[model samples]
Target: MSETPHEYPGQLIEQVRTAAAARTPLRITGGNTKAFCDEPTRGEALSTTGWAGIVSHEPSELVVTVRAGTPLAELETVLAGQGQCLPFEPPHFASGGTVGGMVAAGLAGPARASVGTVRDYVLGARFINGRGELLTFGGQVMKNVAGYDVSRALAGSRGQLGVITEVSLKVLPFAPAEATLVFELGQHDALEQLHRWGGQPLPINASCWVKDDTQASAPNLLFLRLRGAVAAVEAAGERMLREAGGTRMDNAQAGPDWALCRDQRLPFFNAPSADLCLWRLSVPQTAPVLNLPWAQLIEWHGAQRWLWAPASAAREIRAAASAVNGHATLFRAGADGAPDLARFDAPSPAIATITQRLRAEFDPSQIFGQPA
Candidate 1:
């Protein structure tokens, strides 16, 4: 596979056309911020970075359209100017993160449990398929459902089915008020309290729990974010404090703290050394503290958990997650890439069939790398 000399959107089609004709695989690359997300791929590198810029924006209508290669930060800055935001809070992991990578990764931030995920905000998309044909799905508005909503399906496809060219996303108004509160409690108590508050009318936007691995006797810290009307946030803060002793975090400190967690800049996410592997588990919020032999950090009110352990512990780690009806992934593998381990859990037989059929329909030539 060789790099195509063409640079324009139409030229991109020609590149794919040539590849399809030759039956050669082409690996799509954008800001290159998410290379660690999936198994290493092979093929000629097709760069989307060259096709970058916002296409359209309607602040009053709360919608923005942009080229897939547009930088995520640039789009966010544009939305912020209009008092709007992409509430999903996708992580960049590195500079040069693009809108295409954001949608392809389909990762939502702390607000996800309360607001929505990336797929929920995706309105429409245009992509060049394996046959070198361009196709558009869905539309700018929120309610356009004449045919199958393939736009949302492409949200997390990771460029497998096609090369995303443009996208339309629903923007949300920035919250008028916000506050963070910290509570000290054990993991079990924190989980119970999270469930209790989850069932109430309190404006709980996000919750995170961190325990000290070095000192088991130390109490865990539960951080909660409340947002909405100023009065509502104040009232919710008062109620939460009454439930358990808590200290209010300065509004100035809350923003950076949340950003750190979103980007995994906190020490909690570091492996301490390159030898350790990082595992991510998605389970029921009410599930008990996992009985595993690794340090853990709870987020999304216990719906998402992270741990750093040796690659050799993969089996025991996955078993613990499965016991709770959850699934685990080797988020960041060790030096060897966890050769014998599955990065993602296997889907059911029926689901595998449906997925393969869809892949065949969109990419008959298999010009993109196989699924992770």
Candidate 2:
């Protein structure tokens, strides 16, 4: 490969072609903000940051096509200027987080429970498979389609299947009004309220409930953010405050507070001890609050839960999640001599077989990360 800067897709294609010819594994990297999320990979680094730029954006059409390496903050800023945004509200774990990493990580912010996830907004993508073949999937719009939508499949593939070169995403107009409310409630009460509101036409856009470890007698604070038409937001805010006994929190505090939760920078995430492991549980939205021997922070209305517990509790945690028809992942672990626990849950036999087939089809040489 030439040492000269290669900033275009054609150059990236040729680079991959050479790597494929040499049977050399290429580790896809973008802003490198999410490298801690996955296990350390073995391969030559193929930095995608060099190929960054917005390819095409039609705000009038509510679609934007951007290179995979484009920084997520830049993309969001551009959309904000146009009064449009990516409804998924992908989190930027770091200042340099990239669009490719966002999709690969497959994480969404508070609004996920209401609007949808990162994969749902994915309209199309162009990527280079293990064989160095460039392929395009789906399109810019959500038109009727048949068969599989490969673009969405690649959203959370984590560079195991291919190197995403460019992506086209569906955007939404900014809400006309927004408000945040804070309720002093217990875990059970907060969970019940979230579930009840889920069945209604409430304009709730995001929520977070966390216990205050500092004050043993202090009640858990439940933060609810409502967004939509001005009238709807006002109406919902009034109803929630009157019925739920919540006070209207300053809107100014919403952005930074949400950012902390989204990026795992909240005080709850700060480990009291280096040996403690951070676990993420994905259960049904209506699943009852877990009775565990660890502190918990509830997000995504109720589907996403975070637990700060010792690494030894991995089995028990996983079992508890399984009981609720959910899965648990070791979101973060210490480098100290911790036992090796599966980062993700084991798939069912049918899913395992299909995953293997997909890996075989996209990366026959096993040049990417471990299959499935």
Clashes of 2: 0
lDDT per residue, candidate 2, 80-111, as tens digits? Answer: 99999988788777899888888887888888
Q: Write the per-residue lDDT of candidate 1 for residues 125-226, one digit (tens) a residue.
A: 999989989899989997786432689988878888899998999999988999999999888899999999998898888888987676658678999999
Instruction: Note each model's CA RMSD in angstroms.
Output: 3.2, 2.8
Q: Which stretches of candidate 2 lie over 4 Å from their true place?
A: 1-7, 144-148, 337-339, 370-372
Where is the poorest 10-residue window by lDDT in model 2?
1-10
User: What are the lDDT figures for the candidates, one per model?
Assistant: 0.86, 0.84
